[model samples]
Target: MPKQIKLNPLSIYIHIPFCVSKCAYCDFISHRVGDFEINGGVEAYFNSLKTEISLYSGLLEKSKVRSIYIGGGTPSSVDGKFIHNLIMQLKSLANFSDEIEITLEVNPGTLTEEKLNHYIASGINRISMGLQTTNDQLLHKIGRIHSTNDFMTSYEAIKRAGIENLSLDLMFGLPGQTIKDIENAIHLVGILKPKHVSAYSLKIEEGTPLSESYQKGSITLPDEQLERDMYHLLINGLAEKGIMQYELSNFSSASFESKHNLVYWENEAYLGLGVSAHSKLNNERFSNTSRIYDYSKLLSEGKLPIVEKEFIDTSEDLFESIMLGLRLNKGVSINKLNQKYNIDFNVKYANALENLLKQGLVILTEDILKLTIKGMDLSNQVFLQFMED
Candidate 1:
């Protein structure tokens, strides 16, 4: 009998870089919908995106796509038919897993019944909506286009449309945000009962409006201690609602975690299409050009619009696997790492492991290495210890 070979599973991420308006604290590669009208509009961008996906036809043949995520800048803002066509094209190009998980990111005040119908027809089993905060005043301060009522409307609409796996994105640490505000949001989560919730602290990136406001002392953000307190409250509150913590920033009901995101945290291979999207395939990592015009032009010319590429060596790959794996609650398996990297995990990081143990940051048991609750708070410092010196 001949030996059989198993193909590796792949995940796909498509970036839609158009939004109704940019948030005050957002630094992602996204532009206003009206601003790009002169540059051939969303239609042209979709065409370019289609071309980009077709470029990877050969790669698609060798791997089965297990998950597909259509993310920012508000994928739901654009016409849903484009998303449908994109998914249909992907289905034709590759061998989709029988239980493939397809997710689409949406925002409140942008979703309509017609759009929801189109998404349902497109095999979009999951929908992730951004409901940063329930406080209307805080929403305006952050430049969000929707209010709490808008979120409720959209939530009901998605549920009515029959999409069971829903995830909500929540933000904390905003200027003037209090623990009470997070509690309100958490209370809403309990009421709505989403399958997954991703709570993140706001990072004031330079060149953002929020950053400028802070620099001028016009806006005051929650101090570090307050921010930490808010995070702890969020964790405990969500857990009480049956949304247990799975990753550092992600909590979900049992069996309803974001599978697409898990692909990244596990250091698995995935393909990213569209402008500003990134990918990790085998040992190489690359990203598309962030400039919309440049991305469209390159794809139109039958060339990849990759602006950055890095071939991760063995040592770097090992470190990344450890860093990302620690983000999950189950942690990384030492036996799996040893088999994959062909190294004795204990012997390679004996000194760092000793220090981490002494500090009580991480625990290695039976062969699994996982972070303690405190380690999750200071994960950056813990990850720094494992870096190759």
Candidate 2:
């Protein structure tokens, strides 16, 4: 039998794979569903999720959950009752912290006042709404079902539901997006004053509709300089609004940082359930199969649906510790690395560190090592130097 290792203060992620319509830029595991499919598919999916949750009861019993995040193709698109049931089930199965943060991702088109109220009553304390761009033309071009007005309505409903911690997901560098478009979006974010904001640049993911259009020269994104300028604009604008940049793409007011995401960036253990979810526990990293039917069938047959698992070796763990830790503004602790790996970090990567420092990409203090402003932009270049052959 595998040794039972207690994972105290764990984080849980539940993936919901149904969306009313797929966004053009999306590459996540999600499917479009109609009313007929919603009736049967939603129930079947939730049943599989419950069975999967029970499979981890032994591990969960030994752990204390610190955060729970429900993410998806569009979690808010589902019937609110399903979400409520999932939360109630988790509450009954696990030992939750008194101050645990429960976040649910919402899309403007799918949210309703009643649904928001039901979420608030179900112990969900945080709401993350995807409002990629406020420009209706851009929204339609990107296959979003909702307009800026719809986002406003949903935002107001969430506030009226009495949920205080709210996050807005914004994007820049979309096809045909200009600086003015980004400025207008950030201006709206300032007006609403969400507790958190995630401003990400558009990446043309392979197999996505956006990528296909780019391949055919039908979609033209902003150039590299424009994207960088937009990022700087976002940083400066949000800073003036008292939303500090805590991560590369995330900003928040004081004490409003995302605790669930921090679990991943800090290299902490987390449990993931549902189709296409990923998990890291007991020095192992794994992910579930992306296919919903495959995931559900395996659970129905009394099996875990995980399709991939890797036991992280010592060197890989060290590399991940540095790579993930440096993504945060606080950076990594050199002393902790030295202690944990029993190797002098300064000596192990002396050449790489020296080159990075000379390039003004990183700073090494007495204890902590972190990326500089320029380094965060060229982070991939700096991180590549830490890779072990």
Candidate 3:
């Protein structure tokens, strides 16, 4: 019999779906409530997470965990004790790496000097803060609770705590926003000198309040050309400051790229825990129940979360590898493609791939395939054309 190929090592994502308040344009599975009710759910969720990790203990032993990220509703919303307890529990559940990148997603409003200090002591080396935009008017328009000044306070607190691996999130093309506003926002970001930056345009999801506003004609946003201009300007501005664009919206100084996020772009497997989180293990992808009550009820019965799962068919994995590989600026190796999947990216997607080349959307040289400036702009359409059939 042929030897079974071991899966690549896993990264872990733990979702803390509790927030102080939900933004009008936000679509993540985050909750908002009084402190007491939020506090009540922390322990139960962590226990459920521990139970989930226990099931993968064997895989954990076989693979060296790459990165561990705690995201969602602001993870910093929880008290220091919650963070401490959760970290301790994770430590006990798996053979986690000592040098692994442990990132904690925080909101500016929830972090204080003391809280940041405690978080650092608890083994969180990387911090991702959601700043959205520096314009107070735009911030308020989006129903974001944190003001620019609040972000400054929290940023300084993180600095004072000596945590340097930092990333800031920004949004563009919001309602009533202009190129001037984007310029101002970019300048404000320069003041912070964040090691990494991720600036995405506001996407109006169907169920979001902002989307409703758009549907009712209460607000109007920039057109595609303007949005593209904003992205180009953002890229140029960040590049002038020595930041390199690693993926579409993510930028970082040479040494500050998010290791945790890189796992996904590299097409590696990862385990996700908590309500609504998705996991990719042994070529199968699964998501937990989105409803908190359902998740808890199922956990109470000693059942592992398995709301939905699909084995990534061989062809789907091929398309996934291409889609993910193209997202990286470096692209993927042609030789490795043959060794792993037995098909080269250039060969498998040749027809549409040639059309892109003729249209100047893709470029190939030295055994690597990458997107051109025009390609990055139309990348979604390009990737969609090659998806699994």
Q: Of the candidates shown, which would achieve the greatest TM-score relative to the real structure?
A: 1
Q: What's the lDDT for residue 242 in model 3?
A: 79
Give the Å error, residue 39, model 1.
6.9
Q: Count the backbone clashes (under 3 Å) in each candidate.
A: 0, 0, 0
Off by over 4 Å in 2: 1-7, 35-39
- In model 3, which runs have C-alpha deviations exceeding 4 angstroms? 1-8, 35-39
Better of 1 and 3 by TM-score: 1
What do the candidate models score in CA lDDT, each in turn?
A: 0.93, 0.91, 0.82
lDDT per residue for candidate 1 within 252-362, as digits (tens), equals 999998889999999999899999899998799999999988998998899999999999999999999999999999999999999999999999999989999999999
Model 1: clashing residue pairs? none
> What TM-score does candidate 2 get on C-alpha atoms?
0.97
TM-scores of the candidates are 0.97, 0.97, 0.94
lDDT of 2 at 102: 98
Q: Which structure among the candidates has the greatest lDDT? A: 1
In candidate 2, how many Å is residue 342 off? 2.1
Per-residue alpha-carbon lDDT of candidate 2 for residues 1-389, written as tens digits (9 for 90 to 100): 99976648899999999889999989999888574273698889999999999999988888889999999989988889889999898888888989899999989978877787779888999999999998899999888999999999989988888998999998999999999988898899889999999999988889998888899999898999999999999999999989999998999999999999999888889999999999999899999999988999999999999999999988998999999999999999999999988999999999999999999999999999999999999999999999988
Alpha-carbon deviation at 67 in model 2, angstroms:
0.8
Name the weakest run of 10 consecutive residues (lDDT summed) in model 1: 31-40
